[model samples]
Target: MVFESRGEKVFRFAILIVLGLLSVIALLPLLSVISVSFSSGWVVDLNQVTIWPKAFTFDSWQYMIDRPDLWRSFFLTLITTLIGTLLALLVTAMLAYPLAKKEFMIGGILMVGVVITMVFKAPIVPYFLTVRSIGLYDNPLVLIVPHILNPFNLIIMRTFFKQFPKELEEAAFMEGSGYFRLLFSFVLPLSKAVLATLALFYGVVLWNQFQHPLFFITDTDWYPLQIKIRQFITDPNEMPFLASRQEVNYNERTLRSATVVFAIIPVILVYPFLQKYFVKGAMIGSVKG
Candidate 1:
């Protein structure tokens, strides 16, 4: 094999160094959160905790578990992530399929409008008013309804569909398969990679959604985990702890870190399963057409 040039080797080394630094930077905060969450109240207060716990304790996590309201909010977030992801994938795929075909009338105009919306988002007041007018305010549907179609995700999926093999559609048509049959039976089965990717995207968005619930959902019972965590961070005194204990004293930092880790765990758990599909889906969906 030929020896690499000095410049090429230096460039490769630099790229590796940059990527390693980025990885560390991304992971540092998460590690700090977990470490701080586990550390003793005083340790956290002193800001000693970093990559590892200084005086290890589980008081904050225990306190978090003791709160029923936090659990309820977690369940609400879970429900929204699951249902919202599924609905978004289905709706986005449906919208993208027809738009992928050039023969579809109004496809170009609709795409232009979608791009415009993406570039210039609507004002929050109008968005809230529209949601209110539709009776979604204070409803659980507030989390699921307004966020079903993401324009960026839609465009990515449209590109994926546009690059799909036309021969398959032609063969299906020749076999007398209808549009729904062709879509649901054949297209969807072949589109699993993109579907999984978009599902993850939607799931993360729904799970991390704070502003929508903050505005539309007034009832404390309907608050998602993020909103609950926001309240905790904003004012730890308002935390609805179950029972008082003298041995374990938790401060806002401890509570915030625990809530943050709790909220993050689900998405972390989910990413691994979909990791295999992510790169392929993103590349195919975004680069083609």
Candidate 2:
């Protein structure tokens, strides 16, 4: 390694200090939440719970574990995430592949339309009316179907697909291979990094689905995990999940923090596996030759 000058060393040390402070700042809230969740109701009420537990107890977690409704909502969110991600990958790939081809005459026009939608989102009233008209109102399918193809991810995938070797596709076509076979066998296998990245993107979005479910799903049973957490946050008494746990002495703060932690853990667990793919995919998808 090259020897650093005094000025360069000072600059590096300053940058390190700033980054370290920011990291601790970010972590403090998470640590506080964990601490509050484990603390007793009276301790939380006094606001004595900081980055360390004041009164160590598993009451909040025990309450969450015993709640069947919350578990059901968690399972629903998981299923929605898995199904939505798979469908998004399928739809995005199908749309992007044809748009990547220059020979497709309407590709540019369609792409223009997609980009325009990205620039100007549909107004809430019209969007809601459209969903209702499609008979998706008050349905769990509303969560999975309407938001399947994200325009930004579509563009990324299209750009990545455009970089594919045209010769390979031509050579496959010259042989007995059809479009579907060529796509599944060659294109998909080669585009694993981008696919994994997009899958993670879609999965995280679906797992954290709140606004759509809040707007469309009026029934408490159909609420996703985030919506349930929101309900607990806004009005703890109205949350049906805590109905059976009346004997538990958990406060709103502890319960809400625990619920938020539960909502976060699944996505955090998933990121490490796809992180290596994410950077490579993002670069490949964003950069066009």
Candidate 3:
């Protein structure tokens, strides 16, 4: 093993201290919310709950879980996240394949347009008007359709595909494979790392989408969990759209913390499985070409 000099040791120790402090700073809020969610309402009110529970209880979680509105929003977000990520992956892959080929004539022009979107976004008024005209007003698909082909994801995929082996593609073609057949059977099977990374990207975007759902969906029935939680958090009294409204025994503080935790749960659980793929794909895939 190589021995570190005195200066090197000090520098390494400093980096470790900084990283450890940053980790605690990040974890404190999450720990606090969980503690508050489980702690008794009176303890929470008295500011006794911090990073750990003082009087542990499940009252807040039980109350929120019992509400149908919460589940409706939760399931709607879940379905949208799953479907949106898949659709995005399929469409982006199909587009990226053609663009990766140097001979695809209009590919350069299309890429310019894609890059332009990265620099500039559509003005909200015109964007809203256009979507409304397209008949997506209060439609659930409004979330999925607009996000189907993200520019950043497209660039990452296209750049990665540009480096794909041409000989394999030629061999497949010589063996009588069509484009879709080659893609599904050959190219894609070898693309799991980049694809998994993009899926994680798209999945997170669709899952955490708040602005679009809040603005597009006026019908409370179609609201996602983020918006529903926002309503309950802001409203001093019972939320207007909650069915069979009645006095909640749980403190609003505990309920709010629970809702926040609930929103965070899916991401926390899903990220670990994709972490290995994501690290490689995000780093190498984006900068490779």
How do the residues 1-289 of candidate 2 rate in per-residue lDDT, one tens digit apiece? 8999999999999999999999999999989998888888778989888899987889888878888888989999999899999999999999999899888899999998999989999999999999999999999999899779999999999999999999999999999898789898999999999999999989988998888998899999999999888877887575445456666667777888788888888988999999999999999999983
lDDT of 3 by residue, 1-289 (tens): 9999999999999999999999999999999999999988778879988899877888789988988999999999999999999999999999999999898999999999999999999999999899989999899998799889999999899988888899999999999999899988999899988899999999999999988887799999999888888988997765333334434435778889999999989999999999999988787577865
Using Cα atoms with residue i matched to residue i, what is each candidate's TM-score against the true structure?
0.93, 0.89, 0.92
Candidates in order have lDDT scores of 0.89, 0.89, 0.89
Tell me which residue pairs clash in candidate 2.
Answer: none
Model 1 segments beyond 4 Å from truth? 1-9, 239-245
Candidate 2 TM-score over all chains jointly: 0.89
Query: In model 2, which regions exceed 4 Å deviation?
Result: 1-17, 238-249
Global Cα lDDT for candidate 3:
0.89
Total backbone clashes of model 1?
0
Poorest 10 consecutive residues of model 1 by lDDT? 240-249
Q: Return the TM-score for candidate 1, rounded to 2 decimals.
A: 0.93
Cα RMSD of all models vs. native, in order, equals 2.3, 3.0, 3.1
Ranking by TM-score: 1, 3, 2
lDDT of 2: 0.89
Model 1, range 30-143, lDDT digits (tens) per residue?
A: 999999888887787787788998788788899889989999999988988898989998899889999999899999999999999899988989888988999998999999
